[model samples]
Target: MTDTPGVSDPVAGKTTGASSAGVQSSGRTAARGMAWTALSLVVSKLLSFGSQVALGYLLAVDTYAIFALLTTAMIFVNGFQNPGVSKMLIQQHDRLDEILPDYSAFALWLGSIGLVLFLVVGIGFEMTYDVRPLFWVIALAGLSIPLKAATTVYMAVMSVNYDFRAISMAEMKRSLFYYVVLVGAAALGAAGYTMALALAAATLFHVALLKRATPGLRLSWKLTPRRFWQMTVEMRWVLLSSFLFALGMNGDYLLLGEMLSAEELGYYFFGFTLVANLTVMISMGINQALLPLFSKLKHDLAQLRRQYLRISGAVTLMISILCIGLVGIGPMLVHLVWGGKWDPAIVVVVSIAAVLPVRLTANLAGVVFESQGAWGWRLMTLIWDAGFILICAFVGATLDGFNGATIAVALQRLVSGLLTFPLAANMIGIAPRRTVGFFARCFTVYGAVVVAMLLADPWRGVSVHDSTLILRPMLETAAALAVFLAYNLAFNRELMVAMLGILRRKKTP
Candidate 1:
């Protein structure tokens, strides 16, 4: 199964020794994993997007605002829960079965701690911020702690095992279930929709269904205290790094809510959610297989460096193309998918999209970090994350409201992306200069594409009215992609070939 694409043998694609055959059969495994993961994510996103569109149609903006706030708070609380420990376990890949029971206890305990902490935070936030009555509805969603813990365990196990097919299927099922619940609740109106979202652990339930499908793995309730302490000590640095990363990522929303109206915050919130979730989905697809693959190759400096550039370049191209397309047609998408009411969010979406290539690169940096298994390397990102939040807070307070905050976020992410190269190089034992040179080539390609987009239409009208006006965006996007693809093909030949080869393999397989 591992020797070649779709092979029946589990260790068929081994490039290493025969006894350790499965270890070396990662390329085909990665390809198959990426394909299934991509399919699952694309399907799930489409379904979720459809639900959001329906929700937009049926619910009032205020109701959506409440729902968005709940999710944001959930994201914040989840930071304390420290889901990164799961990734750490998968990456470490040593004594996992013995370690699993202990780590599971830690996850449960963390969930308990997170629940208490968040409830306090939630109550204080309401009192201090003087939030609405429905804010309590948001806090009630914390009851899903065990479900989240279970999910962390299951997802980590599957990822470590390179079972992308199982992961993808489970994800697709969860997305469908959530969408069904969402649509059913929305039909009953605002309160029902809110309840459905808060209770949207439908995915967690589906994990049971998945367990039945793959029967060997069993869930254990035994709490191993000593192991739990050991795991926690090991994961403390990971926890800090993850917390900082989350802060940098979500700090803008926190600020927007504090400084701007819920309505304005809602608009920016929607764009930020859409962009971040999409990037996460992409990252998940690649990272699911990449972490274990990178971990296995950690000692092979040459292979590690080669894979790093290939993965990073492919991700950069995908995100850059997505950004170009969205920027060109974002207003129309907002109008068509979300109705005219969300037109305010279009510019925010475009601006966020423009800077997402950097965020994607940062994800590559994360893969490198996870592979290195060195906690201190992530300390630099901790500083970066803190600095970014401070920057956002200062700029958002002093500048033009919501839009200013969004711009600040874009600038911050660009810096994060640039900072990733040296950090990634330090961990992977690559020359910092070589990594920088690779990015410089990518930057040159991206810059040329942007220049062409500007030259073709310096002041492309992005504003929308009654008309759909989809053609202008389509033309602009086509023009941008043409220039970008042609430039990569002509100038960045290796990058172009790698992407084409991945696509071709997927199509043939």
Candidate 2:
């Protein structure tokens, strides 16, 4: 279930006795979980990406702009609904069942609050910007909040069981369902109505699927003032951390929503959403199983440190390759997939892709720290990250407009991600220097691949709307990836071997 390609039962064999058994079980769980999650997420992302491509390609730029802005607001609102109740429950899962009823109440209340909050924000936005038809868009998106809450309780159960297969499959189905509806809606040209219908359908599916998946789990409508208050107090740090993290992540979109023209923002959003969602689809898809796995190893500091290096290192390496690969092919991808109309997003996507390796590293380490209950630690890092990005985005946007803001935000992410290492070292109980090999290996591969891409004639010109030109970049990316794979084979053999083993794993009787 963990995305770490560097560990399984064999790696866990470095330890002995009860700790060894625990690590072994976690390894096995992680291996099986990662297998299903990886395979499933590919399908899920393809489906989700298809829908998005449809939206951007078929719809007008303004239509896409309205869609992106509405989704940005909706995502921002959704973030505040849960501080980390489900995450904390995964850590202290033994008591999860007993508190399930109370947790349901808390989640429901949060969703309800978020719904009202989003509505108010929507009204304010329209009043301020005079953006039309978007208020209804906001309303439809906001209404999905409670329906999503309906799935939270059962999802917690799945997390406790390390059932990433169920979680991943559900996400795949949701994406499939959403894609079907969204693409169909885009075809009919009722952009706002299309979004509203798709959201309603996808969210309702969340409730129905999880209910069947975790049959014994049930939601409670009854709320208790005392218990809710107690839970809120206990989760205060987590709540603030969650809210800050959300604001930090979404702050750029919120800012851009105001700063850029709808068309410009739409182009930026297309690029951002592509990589941003792709990043999460790949990163968090695996992180689904990492938290509980990390929690299990929290007490085994020696094993924890080892697993942290192996897992986080491998993840960073993959991100490096992805960044390099995307940089080489980004322009052609825009042409091949979404059309020449989205050419403005090419630089946006490439710039964002360039800095994403560190972001992924921070995310993988993030679960490690969260598993250790370092809420305060996480909160501080997020504050700096959020603030840095906001300042950078504002200045860049003001000075040069859309492209400047995109690059600035990317730079901010890289800086914040790198600086979190010292704090991450303390939280993960490792020496900060231990992660040096990670940075060296990833950077080496990135440099080598980029050099290879450049040597492969990355600057070659292609005719507009000519589909044949894409093959050149695709070949260039493939060659670049070959360099990455060869570099790993030469120096990262053990990690690669372990990753292959994990991918080949199957469920045992």
Candidate 3:
């Protein structure tokens, strides 16, 4: 090798060639995985949106509120119980096959604990609040915890292997099954109980599919104590962050349910869901991919920093445009879609839509923090944000009812973003001044668009009840997007170039 294994050595050349081929193959696999995942998220969101539309029309406001409340409670419980063990399994660089049994066992134990906690809470709610219907619905839905836990274990295994195609197929199947049951139940005139029952059925079906897809993943209750403790230690902050974040997001719904009538809660929930869906879609599509991508580059700070800033900036620009456009046309779309029944939600949508970009930025930053294993900082940020939202929501609801609550929610998002952006930027090696300047420019552009829309009065003649309800909103949204695109091309050409570069990289290998 002294003289033969140099640059011109045939064996060395073959080795280099094979190494290059391996890198190319890996890149292709990653690209395909991301594509499948993105497609899955889009399809799942569309299906869920369609279901919401159908349910919005089919169910009474109070019924929808009850369903929303139950689901919100379920989310809160799940968040509270998340130990992040599954996430640890995904992020850990070990042989997953060796740990599968232990992970399964831990998940099963956790599920049992969650089930007991839910039952106790249900009883307490029945006793304290005396909301019999809500208590029963939550109690029945709580039965799905074990099924969900099992599904999570299987999903973690799949995710670690980058088998996103399997995950996507499973998700699509679950969504389809759930919607079928939901619509059928609604057609049969079932109320909140329908949601509870559908959740149980869908989860059971999902677990069955997971078992079939992932053979030999038998649920175990034999967790190794040492491994369990290690996971707990690793995931302690993640669990706290999850719980606090969940409380921040869902605590308002619980408060509103307690203070307001079901119908009023329904109106707020509808508006919140509509506006929040856009944020969720963006987060799911982008943030979900960021963790794995960032993980791969964790050793390269410069590359990570460049990617973080570019992606975050691009996300901000895109979301700002969407939010500004929605500010112009959201109310009209709501009117056209749900008519007079949901007209009360218009103000809520407008207020909440204004906060989407801020909230999304903070959310995306959390993904970056997680990828870098910056758990303590993430926890602190989440705690601060959650506390702010909780206090603001309580005060706002107390002061001015639902609309005030919506405003408070928006203000909370704004404060959270302002406070967290510097911290996130610092962790990612991005300068605070740069982050602030970027957001300022985005805000200025968004503000200009809003002012222009107000001056134009695009929705003055549109009527929710009229057949031509979609025309004005469509025209206005299209015009707003066109103008925003032109503005970006002129002033933010660098952002566009960076975005294109990102796309090219994704396609290159």
Candidate 4:
């Protein structure tokens, strides 16, 4: 009967009936948004995986490296432009239509400046290195920033409206078009111009389609100095945070590539890609609706506290079970399927997977920060965590090479996760101990079950060559997952059911 994600009397009887109406309305909106986002995510992930496979098949390894390098460069280019600021549109308390024009103007100026800066850095790299074709890739691919900037406001508008159906379909279609173009180019012969053109084409296409999605919305050339300055102040922290986030995301590749041999780095990438992609599919997909939902309840502290606990607790429970499942099942499947080609990375993969409960739990805290417009607080978490990750990578690589560095990456996430707990608690005015204790209990229950099953792993003796090697691990994984689910149902049933109910298909009148 509760509208919020209640766990053990969330502000028990403190909420008025008027506040409860907002909860019920938000729950419904979140449910619909989540459903579309999930659909889009599944299709997009499949397209992404397929495109990579297709590209790898069509292009030679070295040929594709150029494409990959350019892609990385483009991400940095976008990051430097403080792309995260555009998302501030979703958190604005003002009327969106009133502000959209000014915001769009701000985006134009930001994007133009960004494109110029990207050109400067990129051209410098190419000139200094005397790398052929690099300059064109840099110039052409950089156009997407300006193009994307033009549409960022509209995108934010849709997100605030929770019209995820529009956003989701646009993403899937945009990705599909991009891959199709990229793959076609690879088939002809991989070229930098091809990558840049494909990238630009996709951005323009999405912009055009999104315009159709919001027929009344259009870009305007209107900006006030006060509004512009205010916008800058709002985004200053998040801009730096975005850059640091990009650094943390790609730091492993950059650092490991330099320290380790090509083959060794390849193994590390293999492990990371597997883990990161799974994280994106599960955590990011589910949490996409949080910002808009949180923004709606930002004024309602009692409801925010309850919903935050509900979502964070649910995420913790799910991630704990998933992390253990991946560890339990990964080795057996890798050995049997790839015939141990990736055996060297089993430890690297397992080490990263081991910390998922915390890493994922920490991500939920971000929604609270952004929704409350605590951009500086969000930036602090990123600065400490992202900086620590790179520092740990260096020390870890020096101490233990690839394995050491990856494990260090896991360690940095745990530290960050711990840091996030207090920040989110303080910002939302919830008890830190209560939030921390809830997360801890989730991990403990699932952790004990998974550990017990690992200890009792009966089919440990099965040979990798035997097909039956997977059966026991699979069963044990299933048993642990069942226990985790059952534990939630027994003790945390209301929160679990609330999440399920939100995600359930509601009958329309």
How does each model score on TM-score? 0.87, 0.91, 0.85, 0.84
Better of 3 and 4 by lDDT: 3
| Model 2 misplacement above 4 A | 1-20, 451-470, 506-509
Model 3, span 144-166: residue lDDT tens: 88778788777777766666778
Best by TM-score: 2
List per-candidate RMSD values in Å.
5.4, 3.9, 6.3, 4.5
Candidates in order have lDDT scores of: 0.67, 0.72, 0.69, 0.68
- Angstrom error of the Cα, residue 97, model 3: value is 3.5
Find the 10 residues in a row with the least total lDDT in model 1.
Answer: 1-10
Which residue pairs clash within candidate 4? none
Instruction: State each candidate's clash count.
Output: 5, 2, 0, 0
Model 1 / residue 114 / CA error / Å: 2.3
Question: Cα RMSD for candidate 4?
Answer: 4.5
What TM-score quantifies how close candidate 2 is to the native fold? Answer: 0.91
lDDT of 2 by residue, 98-137 (tens): 7778878788887787889989888877776545787887
lDDT of 2 at 84: 71
Q: Write the per-residue lDDT of candidate 1 for residues 1-509, one digit (tens) a residue.
A: 01222222211212334423343255466556666766786798788678778767776655545655565566556645555757767876776887677666677677777777777766766764434754466556666655676677777787888777888888887778777877777787645245435363574566575676557766665666676667667777777776676666666556556677777766776676566678878777777868878887776555566567765776577667777876666666777666478777775777677778866787778777878776676667756766776677568656877677777777777778788766786565556667777777777767666656545542244454424354766777787788888887787786665555444434211
lDDT of model 3 at residue 138?
Answer: 79
Pick by lDDT: 2 or 4, better one = 2
Model 4 alpha-carbon miss at residue 67, Å: 6.5
